[model samples]
Target chain A: MKIYHECLPCHLRTAVNSVMTMTEDESIISEVVEKCMQTASRFRSYDSLLEIYYDIQKVVKDAFPGMDPFSELKQNFNKLCMDSFDEYIKKINDSSDRFETALKLCLAGNSIDVMQGIKMNHDVLIKAIENALKQPLNKKVMEKLKSALQKSSNILFIGDNAGEIVFDRIFIDYINSEFNKAGHITYAVRGSAALNDVTIKDALMVGMDKSAKVITTGIDMPAAYLPYCSKEFNEAYDAADCIISKGQGNLEALLEENKNIFFLLKIKCNVIAKILDHKYKVDEVVIEAKTAS
Target chain B: MKIYHECLPCHLRTAVNSVMTMTEDESIISEVVEKCMQTASRFRSYDSLLEIYYDIQKVVKDAFPGMDPFSELKQNFNKLCMDSFDEYIKKINDSSDRFETALKLCLAGNSIDVMQGIKMNHDVLIKAIENALKQPLNKKVMEKLKSALQKSSNILFIGDNAGEIVFDRIFIDYINSEFNKAGHITYAVRGSAALNDVTIKDALMVGMDKSAKVITTGIDMPAAYLPYCSKEFNEAYDAADCIISKGQGNLEALLEENKNIFFLLKIKCNVIAKILDHKYKVDEVVIEAKTAS
Candidate 1:
C-alpha cells in the first residue's frame, strides 16, 4: 500500500527505534534520526512505506557496521517459539479442525514482531494465541482458502518474522499433509535481516524445510516488492496457483498484485486496518482473499 | 529543553496534526509534511524542540497563508474555560486555602493543550481540576512561592495556553488581593499564535488586563526564549523579584535561567518528567523553585 500522511510519523518512529536498538549513544542516534528525516522529506505520497523502511535500515546499518539491530531479538523470539512449538502442536492436534487452528496460530504468531515495538514474551504470545483462537475467522474466506489449497498445484507461503515462521511451518505442514498432498508448498523468507523477519537461518532453525521448500526473496527488505526480489522468488510467485501472504508487510507489498492471494494477518496498525477496511479494527485477525483482477 | 530522540516522532506527528487542522487536501498536507521533515533533518542534539516546532509552523503557514490552524480549537477552549470560570471560583471560595486551590486549578488547566493531542471537553477538564485539587502540592515549594509572592515588588507571570490563561487570571487575582497587594504583576504571552498558546488577543479575550498588566514576549514561538523575546519582556523578566513560569513550555525555556523562578506546571511528557526529576511522573503537578545561579 502507498504511504499515508499518518505513516510519516510511524516511519520516523520506526527509524528512531531501529537506531536506538543499535546504539545508546545520543550523537549516533541523533545523526541517524536526522538522516532518516532527510530521507523522509523526499518521500512522495505514492511511495511505499516498506521501500522507505529499507532506506532507513540502510542508514542504521551504515552507522553500526556489520550489526543486525534486531539480531538478539530475532534469536530470542525464535528460541521462544521453538520452545513453545510442542504446546502449539498439541493445541492444533486437539482441535476439531486442525487446519483452522494452525492458521489461527500463525496469525497469532504475527504479534512477535519487533518492528511494532510491542514488548513480547512467551507468556504474552501464548495469551495472544489463545485469544486469537477464540476469535472466529470469516467462514467464507476460510473455506475459499481451503478449497484453493485442494485445487492448486503449487502454493507459495510467504513467511514474515522469525517466531511467526514456526507457526507458519505448522500451517504449511498441516496443508501439505491433509489438504495439498499432490501440490508443492514453497516458503519464502527475506534475503537479509529486516526487523527480525525470517531469514534462511531462522527458517532452518524453526524446521520449516521439513514442511515445505524454503527460499529467500533476496530483496534485502522487509516486504516482497516483486521487481526488486530475486528471479527465483519471482518465478515461484508467478508460477504459484495460490499465494498465502503472511503479515502486514507482505500484504502491503502484494496488495495490488493481479493474482489469487489470501492474506492472513493481525492488523497491527490503523493504516493497514483502514486499507483493508475501515470497519476492521486494529489487532483484528483478518482472512481476506484478493482474486486476479 | 533540548530535543530528545523520542521527540522526533512527536515533532513530526504534531506537524502533521497541525497541517491536518489547516487543510484536508492530501497533496497540500503531503507537501507541508515533507517540508517539516526537511526542516527536522537539520536539527542537532543541542536544538530546542520549541524552536524546531516554530520552523514546522512556518512550513504550515507558508502552505496555507494567513491561517491559524488552531484558531477554532483555541477559541472553543477559551470559551469553555471562561464559561466554567464561575464554577472554579465557587470551588476556590469553598476551599479553606483559596490561593492554593486557585494555583492547583491553574495546573489542572494545562490539560486543555492541543499539542498533546488529547481529546478535551468540559467534563474532562472539571474532573482533572478536581483530581489536581485532591493531589497534594510540594509544601516546601508552595511555601517558597507564597513567601516570594509576599516580598516581591515586581512579579512576572509567563502565561501558557488560551484556556489555561483564564485560570492564571484567578491565581493572579488571588495573589494581588490576598498577598501581593503592593507588588506589580506582569503577565507575559506569546507575540503570535503558536500551538494554542496565549497571544495578546487571547490574553485580552480572557480579561487578563483587569487582573494584571499583559504584554507579549515578541517571540512568536510557544516558549519565552529570552534572547528572542521583546526588550520590554526582558526588562520585566530581569527586574522581577519572582517569576511564575506557567506550564511545561515556560519551564523548558527558562529551566537554565539564573533567576528566582517558580515553575508551576503539570508534567506533560516523559522528556519533561526526566528533565524536572526522573522520580517525578507524567501528569504530576509540580511546584518547583529555582533560585539564581
Candidate 2:
C-alpha cells in the first residue's frame, strides 16, 4: 500500500507511554517492555530510534512551518497534537449511527473539532453520491451482490466509530424500502469504551436500533476482541446474507476475511487512503465483495 | 461556569464501559457514574429530554449543519478549540526559555493530523489563527501575569495532556528565557493514564526534565493526583512561587483552588466557550491570578 507514517516516533512513544501506565498488570507491562527490548535489539539494523525522531520531525514539519525542528517544540507539539486529535475525534463521533459521519469528519480537511463544529457539506455529499450513481455499476459486482443476498436471509451491519453510522441509516432505510428480503438486519457496535462511543447504548441514542435489530460486536479493541470476534461477528456474519463493515478500525481487523461483505468508509489516513485510491481513484471508495462461489 | 453537556448519555455509557475495563477497584468508575447521574438529575429541572436534544441540536447545527447534534462531531470540535487555545498557552507557559519553533507551530495552527486523504488544506489554520491572534489580548489579564512573575521565583507548571505539553515546552522555555528566577520550574505530568498520557516517560521524551525539575501532578484527574503524580507537585504547589495549568481537564480539577496559578487553554465545547465569552467577552480568555502579593 506504500503506506507512509511520518509520525512513527510520536506513535511509538505514545505506545510506550501507554505501556507505562499499565502498572495494574505487571505481565502486560513486561510484555510491552520485552517488545521494546526486541525493538532495541533490532535498532542496530533498523535505526528505529533515529527513524522515529525523523518521522516525528517530518510530521511536525508537515503540521507546522517556520519552526526550528530541533527544539522544545517537540514536547509542546506532542501535547497539542494529542489534545487536538482527541477533540477532533469527538466532533466526528456522533453516537453509533453516525459512523459514516465520523469517517467523513475524519476525512474532512480540519481537525475533528472543526469538522464537527462546522456543518457538513451535504450538497457536496449528495452531489458525490449522485456522481457515484451516474457511473455505470460493474454488472458483475451487482450480480455478485444479488447472488450473495439470494443465498442468505439475515444481514449484519457492523458499525465503525460514531459519525459514519448516519449514512448507514440512509442505506439501511433504502434497503428496507427496496429489498424484498425475509431476513432482519442486525446493527453491530464496538463493545468497549473506545475514544468514540460505539456501544449498544450509542446505537440506541442514534436510533439505529429503532431502524434495525441492535447487537454489539461483542469484542473490545486492542485487548480482547480477536478471541471472540470470529464467534460473535461470525454468527452475525454467517446468518447474514451480506455484511457491511464501516470505518478504518473495522477494515484493519476485517479486510482480510474471506466473507461476502461491502465496506463503507472514507479512506481517512494516508496508508489506507493510498491503497483504496490505487484501487478506486476516489479517496473515499466503497468496496463490495461477493462470497466465494 | 454554567456548564452544559448534552452528551451525558454517551458519557454515561462510556463511563460504564470504562468501568468494566477497570481493574478490581471500581471506585473511580463509580464516582464518574455518580457524577453523571447527578448532572442528569440537575439538568432535568431546566428542560425535558426532547428540549435538551433540540438545544444540543441547535448549537451543533449552528456549528456544523447536516451534522447530527448528538454525534461525536461536537466533541471533536471541542478538541480543535482546545488545540487552538494551547497555541496561546505555549506563549507564556514557563516564562524562562523560549521554544520558538513550538511557538511558531502553535501560531501557525499546524499541530495535528487533519486526516484528509489527498486533498489537504494548508490555509485553513493560518486563517483561523490569524483571526484568533488579531483579537487584542486581555490587557487586564496580562498586567496580572507580569506582576505575578515579577514577585515569583519558583514556578510550577501543570501539564494537561501529551500533545499540549509540546506547546508547554515553549512556555517553559519562555519562563527560562525571560524570567530571572532563582528557584527552578517544576513540570507536573499526570501520574496515571486517564485517557491522555502524561506519565514521567512522556515527560522525559520531550526533554521536559532538562528544562525543569520534573514532577508528577501527584493526583489523578477525578481524584486529583492519586498514586501517580508524586507528592512533589503538591509540595511544589505549596512552595512554588507561580503555577501554570494547560488543558480543560486540569482546569476543571484545579480552577477553584485558591492558589496563584495561570490557566491556559482554548475554550472547548459550547458550555465553556459560552461562559468564557460571557465573562470575558471573548471566546478565548486567559485567567490569571491577581498579581502575587
Candidate 3:
C-alpha cells in the first residue's frame, strides 16, 4: 500500500498538524509541510499505505527535534477517556453480552485518534463511545474469537492509542473474567511516540498492570511492523495463538501475515475503507477474520 | 493571496488528474504527480492561490507534450452548456428581471468547471443553472451594477471557461440590449489552453465573436495575471469603462486592482471563499464591488 495521490493531501495535513503542536510559527509548519511534500513525492513505494505517515513523522521529528509533538494532546486525550472509565465499565456490566459490549467499547476508542487532525474532547469521546455501543457489529467475529480462545493459549492484544488503551484494558478485564484458563493476554503497545500511539508507559499509566501484561514492540509505529519489532515482541507474535490487532496501522502491517489475526478497528482512511469494501469513515466497526496470508 | 497549505493537495490531485487524462499509465501519472509535488514544494510564495495552478499546468504540459489534457473534458462540458443554451435564453426572456436572470445564468455556468475535477454532464449543467436561478442573490450589487453601467463604456467582460462562456454570451446579449451605451463589451478569454478556460478560438466557436469583440491575454492562465498579460490586454484593462470579471480566476487576478471591476463569479476554492467570507462551494452568486487597493 503505497501513497496514492488521494493520500498525499492527508499526509500534508497530518504533517502540518504534528508540527503545529510543537510551535505556533506558521513558517515552521509551512516549511515542515513543504519538506514532507518533497519527500512524499519521491516515494517509489512504501511497506504499507500507513508507511506514508512515517514520511510525515520523520519530517515532524526533524523540525521539532526530540520533542513528542503530540505529548500534551495524548495526555489530554488520556484524561478525557479516563473520566469516562467508570461510565464505560458500568455500561459494559449492564449489557447482557458483556464480551461483545467490551469489544464495541474497544472499537469506539479507535475514534479518539488525532491522526486526522480533529480535536476530540470529552463530550466527543463519550458520544463516540455511545454511538459505537448502539451500532450493529459482526456477531460472527465475536463467536470466532470465543471459539479461538477455547483452543488457543497465547493472546497478543496490540493496543493502539493512549486514551483508547483504557478501553482495551476494559476488554482485557472482561476476557480474563470469562476465559481465565483459555489464554494469558499480552498487551503490546508502540515502543515510543509515533502520532498518539500508546507505549508501555501509557499502558501502565492507564492501569493495564492490574488487567494484563503490557509490553512494547520496541518500535514507535502505530502498527506492529514485525521486521523492526523487538525480539521479545517477535517471539510473542510467533507464540500467540490469537492476534488481536488494533487500529488501521496494525491492520495495514499484518494484512498479509500468516496468523489468526482478527483486525479489530474502526475503518479509517479510504485505502483501508476500499480494501474492506466498506464506506469510508472513522465510525464503521470492521472485525475482519483472516489467517496468515 | 499566497498559496495556502490547503492548496498543495489540490495541486497534487489536479496534476494527477491532468496527467491521467493523457494516459492510463499509472507510472506516468505517478511520475507527473511526483515532479509536481517537488516543484510545488519549492514555492516561496505565489502572486495568488490561483497562480499555483500554473505550476500544475506546466507539469501537465511537460509530461503530456502538446496534448491539451482538458480538451475532451472541455468539449463535453462545452456541449453540456450548449445543449441548454436555448433553454436558458428562453427562461431569461420569460423572467420579469431579464438582466438579473441572465447574470444568474452566467453564475450557474461557472460550475461547469474542470479544475475541481467534477464530472459535469448535460444533466448536471441543467440542474446547476436551474438552482442558480431559484436562489436569492445580492440584489444591492445588482443595483450597484445598474448604476455603474449607467455611466460606463468599454465593458471589458472577462470570460472564464469554454462551455461556461455560452452562459456569459447570453449575459453579453442581455447587456447589449440593456446598456448599449456602455460601449462595446469586449470579451477577453485565455490566449491559449489552461484548464478549461476559453481562448479566442473557443469564443469564436461559441459565437462570442458575434455578440462582442473577442480577444485574449496571450497567456494561458485561467485568470488575468496582469504582470504576465499582453500589452493589448493591459491597455484594455486600463481603458475599459467597467470590467465585469467572470469566474473566480479573474476575480482572484484582479481582486485589488485600481479599476472599478464588478466580480461576477460563483466563488470557488477556500482561498477566495475566506476572502469573500463566503462558504466554499459553486452555488452562491457573489457580485463584489471593489476598486483601488
Question: Using TM-score as the measure, which candidate wins?
Answer: 1
Please report, in order, the local distance difference test score of every candidate based on alpha carbons. 0.84, 0.47, 0.78
User: Interface RMSD, all models, one decimal each?
Assistant: 1.0, 19.8, 1.9
lDDT per residue, candidate 2, B204-246, as tens digits? 6656777778777654332233223456666777787777766
lDDT of 2 by residue, A38-135 (tens): 33222223322334232322332333343332123222222333333434444434445233333333223212211122233444444453443334
- Write one digit per residue (lDDT tens) for candidate 3, span B142-208: 8888888767777788988878889989888888887874237888999788878888767877788
**Per-prediction DockQ scores?**
0.69, 0.01, 0.46
What DockQ results for candidate 3?
A: 0.46
Chain A TM-scores, one per candidate? 0.94, 0.53, 0.90
- Regions more than 4 Å wrong, model 2: A1-293, B1-144, B163-167, B182-184, B192-196, B204-207, B220-232, B239-241, B266-293
- The prediction achieving the highest DockQ against the true structure is 1
- Name the candidate, 1 or 3, with the larger TM-score value: 1
Candidate fnat values, all = 0.85, 0.00, 0.57
Best lDDT goes to which candidate?
A: 1
Sorted on TM-score, highest at the top, how do the candidates line up? Answer: 1, 3, 2
Task: Tell me the tens digit of each residue's lDDT in model 3 across A114-227.
Answer: 766567887777777788888887788788987886667888999888788889888888888888742388989888888888977687778887887777898867789887
TM-score of chain B of 3: 0.91
Model 1: colliding residue pairs: none
Window of ten residues with lowest summed lDDT in model 2 chain B: B110-119
Where model 1 places Cα greater than 4 Å from the true spot, the runs are A1-3, A25-27, A44-47, A90-101, A126-139, A173-183, A283-285, B1-6, B44-49, B93-101, B127-139, B173-183, B266-270, B281-287
RMSD of 2: 19.7
